[model samples]
Target chain A: AQTVTQSQPEMSVQEAETVTLSCTYDTSESDYYLFWYKQPPSRQMILVIRQEAYKQQNATENRFSVNFQKAAKSFSLKISDSQLGDAAMYFCAYRSAPSGTYKYIFGTGTRLKVLA
Target chain B: DAGVTQSPTHLIKTRGQQVTLRCSPKSGHDTVSWYQQALGQGPQFIFQYYEEEERQRGNFPDRFSGHQFPNYSSELNVNALLLGDSALYLCASSLNSYEQYFGPGTRLTVT
Candidate 1:
């Protein structure tokens, strides 16, 4: 069985500063994908960034980036130039890369508070 | 193109009652997946439908059932609901096995 862990229950960041949310997972599969999702008060789960296990280069989406360490089984999200709008619940997710395995295993989540 | 859409936006049902939630996949997407997200928790996978048939399911009980139409639209039906079933039901659609696009989610409140 595979599981994702987000140890930080909550995190705070000052406006325009950077913040990193840590996540780790237990998985036996070598091929998989990691993701970071953001859910605001509106209840919409938005994809922030994704990293493929096969890719050594980390994934970056504008202000958001990921530090994916496949061997360590750790994937973390870093938000640069954090703004008030960045405050939300962030979730780390894992999905098997094998065909037909479509379900996503998610971490409990970390509440991000961006202070002005 | 419109993203995944679910309705009604909110539903309130009593315990032991049955409830149905609907989802319309995004344009060009043929796979639909459902998830349950409890308050302050991450979303849990429910099931996935493709080719109008269920291809995958999670750890949910048989009381939780679903259907996918020929048009790729889907419905989630829960029977004998419990208070623990109260949560945000999310619908996601993808083309093949690509990244999924999520809906705003329907908030189901079981009293």
Candidate 2:
């Protein structure tokens, strides 16, 4: 069984500043995928970024990037120049790659509050 | 292109009653997956459908059933619903195990 853990229940960051959300997962498989998703008050889940386990280089999508440490099994999301629109519930997810199951294992989520 | 779409943005049903939620996959997507998200919690995988057949399922009970049509659209049917079943039902679509695009979700309230 695989599990994802998001240590922060809530986080606050001033607008135009930076913040990092921590996430860790336990999995036996060597090949997998990690993702960060944001859900706003509108109830829509939006993909923020994704990282492949085999890729040593982290994944970056504009202001959002991930710090993936395969040995430590830690994948963190860093938001640079946070904006008010970035306020939402962020979830970390894991999925097996290649021939494994396609189901996603998600973390409890961290509610981000962007202060002005 | 339009993203995944779910029907009846909100639904209110009584306990012990049955409810069905519909989902239309994003254009060109052939795989549909369902998830249950409780208040303040992460989404839980319910099941996934491909080629009009169930390919994967989570720890949900048999009371939760689903079907995928030939068009790749899907429906989630929960029988004898309980208060615990109340949550946001999210439908996601992907192309061959790629990144899934999520729908706005159907908020099912069981009272």
Candidate 3:
């Protein structure tokens, strides 16, 4: 009964600028995993970054980073120095940690547009 | 090594018809998961196959079935399809870790 929420339906940022996409989730499990995935117009889903609930330190992958506020139930994606290639539909996902539990609940995506 | 791969990139089916989608997991991956992504929406988990058996499933109906081969490849079968069943079917592969690698997805259009 876990759910992920992406408040923004669409977002736009100028090239070289930074953009942040917001996401929140509802889960009862203390230990879990959060992920951000990007789907381009080509319809390929690509993993952007991931953060574990136990890790206090946020996750960062080059220009992509996540601001994970466990208590607030918020996990946001921050894209630095945005490029045109970064334009895509971004989805936030939640997965439980227990064995035999592989269901991944996802949020309604937020489409990102990078302007040149 | 190649990432996850799906067969018949596009498929068109009519109402009440049945369809099957195939997936080949990435090298060394033994687990495969299937997801359904509707237009303008995120992908929803349908099921996961491991060790040639179903390990997990979502809130889908019984009409949505699947099978995993000995090679770790998998197939998603949808019987008596509905118009609402039209979506992008994605296949993901993983080891014992939580991280999963996704395929390009098969676009299914049910008319």
Q: Native-contact fraction for each model?
A: 0.87, 0.85, 0.90
lDDT of 1 at B24: 97
How many residue pairs clash in each candidate at the backbone level? 0, 0, 0
Regions more than 4 Å wrong, model 2:
none
Candidate order by decreasing DockQ: 1, 2, 3
Overlapping backbone residue pairs in candidate 2 total: 0
lDDT of 3 by residue, A40-94 (tens): 9998889999999999999999999999999999999999999999999999999
- In order, the TM-score of chain B in each prediction is 0.98, 0.98, 0.98
TM-scores for candidates 1 onward, in order = 0.98, 0.99, 0.98
| Poorly placed runs, candidate 3 (over 4 Å) | none
Q: Model 1, residue B29: displacement in angstroms? A: 0.6
Q: Alpha-carbon error at B85 in model 2, in Å?
A: 0.4
In candidate 3, position B64 carries an lDDT of: 98
RMSD in angstroms between candidate 2 and the native structure over all alpha carbons: 0.6
Scored by lDDT, the top model is 2
Tens-digit per-residue lDDT, A3-65, candidate 2? 999999999999999999999999998999999999999999999999999999999999999
Writing each residue's lDDT as its tens digit, candidate 3 over B8-40 gives 899999999999999999999999999999999
